[model samples]
Target: MTRIALATASADLEARFRAATGGAFLPLPPAPLPSNPAHLFAQLDGAPAPDVVVLDAELAVDHALDLATLLDEQCPQIAVVLVAEHGPDLGLAAMRAGVRDILHPQAEIAEIQSVLDRAALAAQALAHTVAPASSDAPPATGRVISVLSPKGGVGKTTVATNLAVGLARTAPNSTVLVDLDAQFGDVATALDLAPEFTLADVVHGSAARDSMVLKTFLTLHETGLHVICGPPSPAAADTITSEDVSQLLQMLSLEFRYVVVDTAPGLSEHTLAALDRTTDHVLLTSMDVPGVRGLRKELDTLAELGMLTPARHVVVNFADKRGGLSVADVEATIGTKVDLRLPVSPATRVATNKGVPLLQSGGRDPVTKQLRRLVERLTIPETVTAQPDPDSRPPRHGRRRGR
Candidate 1:
């Protein structure tokens, strides 16, 4: 059964909930609580978190909206649903704000039951996937390669765009790139594609309401690499919660062979949620003291969050031995060996200015070669032997930092 936390400003919530769910749900508090994220989190802050939180419309809309965003960021495992006076009217905004279901306050009993059933099913599947299973478990079916940086202005979007185009050379239409920088994202600007529909539109539009409806929302690049740009407006970003990211990544993984994500600086809630479902992490940084050190600290946080088990790669962008720091120095600082080092090239800046990716720009420059090599590294199989091979041993405390 699905453990559901019911919150409302209505006093007769229990009586009405029973009539709606027919005593089927395992409601937390065994009664109604204040319809807010803090109160709900206080009640169920420990192990065995509820699968969903059903918010009633009696509470203030702004408060409920804030709670929905907070709950998704703090407890992504638990989905959120809201009962509104005009459920259908809320539509895209409701889903964009991390609501799995928006039901009319007087919604049908069956409709309520169906919504609860979906939450329960998703929770059960995630539980099975996230349980502390054997470390030797086989690799997952799909790979989510996330490009992140602890500081801004590190060429993260540049690397992400180039890598996607490089991978598309081998995978054709099977490669996709996603821009997760909600506040200030330049993937669309870099690629020079005027996408009338962006990630925010997908999240707030009817297309994102279902996983199977993947079309027109993603702008197709000339290299056959699909692109999912960030929100056109900063205000639209507030509506996209972490859970929405998880669902989008899951669906994208199903549709594409390679799901390349370019995230904002540092670990935002949306990035962390995507990391949980990711298979490969491309941590990007510049060859500067603050930039590399900040990435090192972010690595520690990811370790504490049990994110080191996946394939982790450190990419040092704008490398110049004569400038600031060398490749070896970067590796020593980040505590992880540099997997790819991109040289500072004027071609990269020109490509970005012209709305074209480095690889697709068709320049036989050093940056283009490195971009191809990056994809080649990703294509290699990660096979392990039963015994240690000193010659090719993996990085120490790098793959499984927390363990």
Candidate 2:
């Protein structure tokens, strides 16, 4: 249960807060905020320490901020929210003092409830990250395959969704696809899912620290695949950090048999964090000159960074004889063999528009055939472990290849 303590003088505000929390708050003295977390806890009168402390900043703004800073240092798990007139100057000060959010004095009950919910989540995440490990044994992880491209409109999302669905078919309830594009991901639309929670929601709070809680956040697809879609909007992407991405993937890899990632076109920090945990990479590119050249540069960059995984599958999408590009030409440009070729097909576009993967619909279209082949490459245990080329040097960071 979420514990809340309110320190406000206004009786009207207290009544609204009671309405919002169903009369479940512990009310403290109205004025003169406590000097520290210990003093504040003593005011609880032997009750459990609150998860959230709502301070009325209308009277003693400086004292509220100082108390917030003390709580941040001493009781970091407690999220501090200030009730004050919202302003740019106050907002900056509150943030500096470790305030989770600043609410207006006249907030409605519904708004109060929303802010409390967010504060509780923030508290949970703070506690989890600051907590130490319980065991010394290394965690057992599953295979993580990341599908990426250097340019947009290269069909990486389509490939990623289809691959994840196909894997789920082979191993029900053991696969998850994460749309790490952050800003403009469309995995939810491709799967026709209305997710109650998203990547932004799962990467923090109790969901981030507990595997069972995290599982509840995933949207269940009809194909039996679990999915963590991107943030609800572009602005939400800013709140998710690279460390959050890394931790989220590590937790997921421990539970799922296969964790498939669909990243943005370029290598953002989030993408790099995902790549750090990826065991296999499905490098995709279109048949055009720009796509091919970009793929070459991406390969060089990955190689330099020592992030090129041993089990890499280079895919050429939109392959056509009339496009003035051949598989051999692509191989020559990238200095790597093309492991898969998906021919251009109108049915593929129609399936995407209809929010159904060709593989999920059991279509016999040419794209579906290639998608099945790609799935086989990942599902078969032997295929997942590729023999490293003798000529290439080992990874720079000495990161192990297999689990």
Candidate 3:
């Protein structure tokens, strides 16, 4: 549960916060907003630190901004959200102070809940980065695969569809594919699924409340993979945010063994967010000048932004010796070996138009064989001999003395 410390002086707003969180946050004493600016930080420091600190910007915008800055320096772990009327000065100051968001003080209850949920997810992500997982413990979290491309018409959806089908065969019902091309996604058409629920449904639904709730929102494919298609229309896509994707992935990670994301062509806000959370990056490019050049720039950007920590495998799709660019040339241009070269197969177009994955319908042809190899790569068993298990963590010295 996310613990939110509500520092607003308005009794009505405080009541709203309590109702909106719906017992998600830990109980705390009535918040004290010290009138004296000097004591504000000290007052907050004295209280039990919460996962989030929601400040009332109406009280003292300057003092709130300064206090947010101080909290960021002194208590960096705790997220801060300033609730104020939208204003240029306040928004700028809050951003400079590293506040999570500058929201309206009188926003609807649902809005406040969404903000709190997002803050909780951010806090959890921060913790995961800082805390080391026990080597003895098997990976209980799902593996994330992000299919990315710089320009349109390079077949990102095709790669994502085949990869998800391949993974589903390996992991069965423990797989999900998200069509994150919010405005324009064809995952449903690619697989011939007329999903009743798209990503918008999942976001609007209380799927975040429980992973099981999320399952109901998924469209089960004959391939044994569940899917969350993109918005049916572009306008609805605007309602979805990067924060929504972050929270959705976190929840999905708990339930599914693998989450394959089909991102829109080119980098968008949500695509970058998906990249931030991905464990594997299947960077797909065609054997062409623009595609090669775009992959280089994409690599440079991912490197600069620190998104390369995830294992990145560059796949040269539609590769052919006679193509304008050779495999060697493409590899030299990207500064990375071509991990997998996927040839353009006639079977691909036929299967896509038929709404079945090539991996499902191609029947062990060269393309399906290659797709199977990719799944085989992901299913390699971990070497347990190198790591200690939880049972071996404690010493048994006292028993030895008695013996």
Best by lDDT: 2
Query: Could you tell which candidate, 1 or 2, scores higher by lDDT?
Result: 2
> In model 1, where do residues sit more than 4 Å from their true spots?
1-140, 382-403
Q: Which clashing pairs does model 2 show? A: none
Compared to the true structure, candidate 3 yields what TM-score?
A: 0.61
Query: Which structure among the candidates has the greatest TM-score?
Result: 2
- Of the two candidates 1 and 3, the one with more favorable lDDT, higher being better, is 3
Model 1, range 1-403, lDDT digits (tens) per residue?
6777677655465566777677755445643444444345445433234677787755566667777876665455667888776645576767667777776676666777787788777767765664546678753445789988889999999989988888888899888899999889989998888876678766644355433234435688888888889887888789999888888888788678899999988888888878877878788888888998998888777766666544666778888888767888877777667777888899988998998887886878998888887887777766211222223333333224335
Model 3 agreement with the true structure over 248-288: per-residue lDDT tens digits? 98788877899999998887988877876787778889899
Per-prediction TM-score to the true structure, in the order listed: 0.61, 0.66, 0.61
**How well does model 3 score by local distance difference test?**
0.75
- What lDDT is reached at residue 87 by model 3? 78
